[model samples]
Target: MVTAMASLPHIDNPVKLAVKDVAISYGGRTVLESVTFDVHEHEIFGIIGPANSGKTSFLKTLNRMDIFNPSMTFTGQITFNDRDIRKWRNVYSLRKRIGVVFPLPVGLPLTVYENVALAPRLSGVTGKADLDIIVERCLERAALWDEVKDRLDSLGSLLSGGQQQRLTIARALSQEPELLMLDEFSIAVDPVTTMRIEDVLKKLKKEMTIVLVTNLVQQARRLADRMALFLDGEVVEVGITEDLFAGQVKDQRTKDYLDGRFG
Candidate 1:
């Protein structure tokens, strides 16, 4: 059953990520414009919009992933844990604290155990016994342990699409990130697998902040503590999920989208 945001207990958590007047551009064309929002600690913040609405573009900026593209340009400020991202001397260190999962699974051509262990190993976990525990713990959290525990030595790429996605998630979990971002996570996943991952996310929010960028509004409603609706590179509305769906939206465009009038 889906859990509505309105029914969830409210916690006065401190801000984990703050985006202020943030905008993104590529080769002189603006992708997102002047977006501002605060994601509270341990809350699931959902970003929803139609195609080309700049949702993914904005997600990339959270951990400075946009820097990989020379053509990408950013304006305004994005702060993580109250510190400006621009001042972070080691971008890798910043990324270590933030995990990201993309629309499709990109499993490395390595065994499932090796795939999940890679992150912890890079972080200096050298003891064999410690890596074993970390790998099993993360895979369990990803809802994949029961299915893959016996096949830990099997190549990750050989798994089914849904299983590969779960493996990718397990890899991300190995980082034990302060913030976890998922961009269209259900796109390639089966419905059952999606539901299983959703359950994992529900439990995960108790430990870390989450940023979910999805086109599925219902998914946002089920998982978000607060949501922002983006349209045509602009934020149309942002509010408690229930308020946005209660037919009393401040913006008519928001109501239109919610009512299925148009994307």
Candidate 2:
């Protein structure tokens, strides 16, 4: 089981997610296999890989999103809080605890305020006062509050691309998730917005474990404490982010990918 060595304080934190010998398939055709890793609490664990390497597919499996795809099949153990995810009786309950952000923002048809409040309301957090607090707090966490506080009643779809992306993050935060998984979140946003969101992520890791699957190798280096390099549907290496950059890697491909030689 190859895995990264955790950097201080974060190493002391308990594991928030664990995946062992995991494999994925589509219509019996294997896409990824023998994957294993643990995401420690309150830390950013990055997965860097080139396209079609199964990075996004792997993240979907963690939240059990496979249930929505009839052709997708998976085998292996995935656990959260030491309980196998496959053993969970309620799929929605599992998802609520593990939020996901896609490569591109998908804004709801509802108002800005409603988008952030929808999850809590569905979870039974009703009272207007309570909803207000939850909505504001989530927006604040996503760094969208100040920009849209006055436009709360506007439709989320009406927000600019960057604002909508942040709105997506705010909606995820509304779930009050224990683990947040972002799959190429900056793909559609501008560099400025990407940096802003990255800054927000740094602060957010203090509140929840984060799994960041990005194609940008430098982005991983800047934010990840520990990370894994995935290529051709395999994890080539896992180590402290700097250690990999410093050439402390078992696979030459790992250093090559990090150095922009390929990937």
Candidate 3:
């Protein structure tokens, strides 16, 4: 219910996530090799790649989704909060701190309010008044409150494309996650709505660390403080957004890709 700006504590170690010499394989075919990176607190870190370049696979590794793939094998360390992610207090607890928004909106059978409140309720928030406040704050943060305020009782499937996407974002935000992973969030929405969502992300990044995976070069250039280019299952380059686009990357592959010669 508290709509105040999120107060981040001053810690000596500020990085939120770190991947250290990590490698992943499926059916003995390597998909990621020697991937290494650090995601700082409250910053937007963008990942860009062409199709089948392991962008989504790397994201799945962050939340331990690789465990679900029977053919997937992981090596090396993925550290979160200075501790190995595998050693985190619990997988579920780690997931609660990191939320994910996928490319398309998923319709729930419940009404809009229930859809947003379901996770919070599972987390032991049962008070009606508290649920109302959380839902309103989340919707407002996602920039959907104004449009859906009068339709709180409507089924989630009743929303338009843009509205449903925003609703999914609102649902994710209701958990108050410290890190938000957005995988092609704007791909399914209209241009105007995508811009709105981008603006919302800019505001949200003031409080949460945002990891964005998008195929659009422009989107990464516009919103990212830092960026990583992935190709052939490896990180080709990573640096400040302006630096990456300024023809300063050391890797030939990255430079070529940025110059529209290759991907």
Candidate 4:
């Protein structure tokens, strides 16, 4: 669905990420099954489910962090730009193209400037002028620049809870990812700030693919272009946001969940 690409204002805008028949297990117990999906360029995709569903586990697979857990095992192909993820020349390079923001504001111990500038510097952008420009641009995009610009030297942890979440988002944006994956990113923030983050995401999706794993059904209904319902390790259904919330979904389980009948 919606396979056209390279539209004006967005070239090289093909499918940025694809997960096909992907499954995962821990200690021989399966967690996900036959998961297949594509995150298109500049679209916001929402993955919604109850707590303990495999939302985070699925996001972890996109970045290949799932391979680190000793008990975890993954099967099937996760491709970026048509290249098999396992075959990616450098995992870090792939990760740089897909940034993640977690539910908690886990900012680094470093100052805000350093946190945002670290990856760009490591990627060979050594010029102070260039780094300064990048840091400012990403922070501004994440809606934290106006607040943090004058306090670039301040530690990120010192910011308020909402600001810290935005700081973490700014740090992810600093990498200039083609796709941004947010895992319940507003869970730890206030409602007002959550709305602010949602607004930022609405703007950001015009330039980057956004995959949001959230439990807030209303948020998904409001912000997503497409929505996927995850249940018991399977993608129960996926369709346009309007279709899913409009009671057109064909599956009983999905309808029940949407109606608050079950998780």
Candidate 5:
């Protein structure tokens, strides 16, 4: 059975991700400073902040995507599924368990079916029948199966902006990740499509943890079980979604941001 938003599990649930004193820098410039939080299993954890607040940088670190940058530096401990990420021998294997979707739709030039099947194929599932089932299941979970079922053979890049974003989500779901991170997923998506994806996320939380980085406070309020508010590279506050918005914040900055006082 799918859990409803109103009855979502409490923040005290077992932690899926534990970030302790995490800090990141590019070259000599600090991006995130001493951030710490816990993401409960099977819950939607929202990260909200203005541009350049290190929201995306933090998300990348969760999956070790920051390794692509030669100048990137990180300090502190990030543990996933009770194991320290820094000590992981296979970063690629770690990433396969943590899926990520970026702000913009980055659809591969391949067909819609291929786009969803690529990851599974890379993981060595080459059976045609198995790939077909995986592709259909992922697309259906992303709320995109019906729209693209007829055009599975069509190029992914040929889809509209909203469709392409959903396609990216389907591709991410294909990995069957233990945790899923979405960075400003609604930016390029239409309002209707955004709501549809949000519904998908609500259903998905029953299966895996979600880290949602969004600038829209209301969006966070609607989907997040709890949230951490970021400002100037710091975690200003973290608490239950309703309690935070109900004016039970720890810092003035948090209340200010929630009240539209400032970014």
Candidate 6:
């Protein structure tokens, strides 16, 4: 059986994302507080928590998705590539560099080929040849190309739920994001498909930084070089994935959660 590296591939890599004393709120109620962590370049940084732990809310803050929700608020400092993301005047440009995949598959109503081509086209790739190359490369990266290569003309929505999820991944990769964030991407996926996507994520980390928010501790253990445990809107601990399971934790509750005694 294959196994993930016992430690980070590049432990000394510079920080790609830094969250300092961050807090997220909705309508004046804090959902996540005191979140401080640094995600290193080209590493899969996992966030694991139970429901209502503010994991999703924290992800929104990273990409500045709060702009879509007026009631949502963020405090503290978050830097991407050593630059304050809040200072960016162009949210579109920020989003282009940070791709996000939500819990559910959001396949566009367009054909499979078009769905993956849309981002490149919007980014000014007009040549059909260039688009074809991009579309194939992205789909292959997402592990969906071989299955749907012949069905590129089919509506993306017509694919199986797992296939659609992979399509969403392919679409995100088409942007060539420097940082990719996925929120519970496997919730709707089957075990087989989940494993396939996990393999894809393992390979993708070599190409980009990935922030993975998952409820499955085992999944995080398998993929993350390091991980943070979020409980009730607070980060309880952050450490190397293997070390955490080897009885390292700041709080007893974290140990319990990792042991499956509680979520």
Residue range 93-137, candidate 1, lDDT tens digits: 999999999899989999999999999999999999999999999
lDDT at 44 for candidate 4? Answer: 89
Alpha-carbon shift of residue 144 in model 3 (angstroms) = 0.7
1-263: candidate 3 lDDT, tens digit per residue: 01111321212238998888988889999988988888889888999989888888888888888778889878889988788988876888888878888888875778999989987997899999999999999999999999989999999989998898899899889889999999999978999999999999999987899999999999998898778998988998987777778777879898888777893
Pick the winner on TM-score between candidates 4 and 6.
6
Error of 1 at 231 (Å): 0.5
Q: Decide which is better by TM-score, 4 or 5.
A: 5
Preferred candidate (lDDT higher): 4 or 6: 6
Q: Model 3 clash pairs?
A: none
Each prediction's TM-score versus the true structure:
0.95, 0.96, 0.92, 0.92, 0.96, 0.96
Instruction: Spell out the clash pairs found in candidate 2.
Output: none
Query: What is candidate 3's local distance difference test score?
Result: 0.86
TM-score of 1: 0.95
lDDT of each: 0.90, 0.90, 0.86, 0.86, 0.92, 0.92
Residue-wise C-alpha lDDT for candidate 4, range 44-145, written one tens digit per residue: 889999887788998888888977898988899988878998898799998999989998988899999998998898789999999999999989988889
In model 1, which range of ten residues has the least summed lDDT? 1-10
User: Clashes in model 5: which pairs?
Assistant: none
Q: Of 1 and 3, which scores higher on TM-score?
A: 1
Number of clashing residue pairs in every model?
A: 0, 0, 0, 0, 0, 0
Q: Alpha carbon lDDT of residue 217, candidate 2?
A: 91
**In model 6, how large is the Cα lDDT of residue 142?**
94
lDDT of 2 at 160: 93
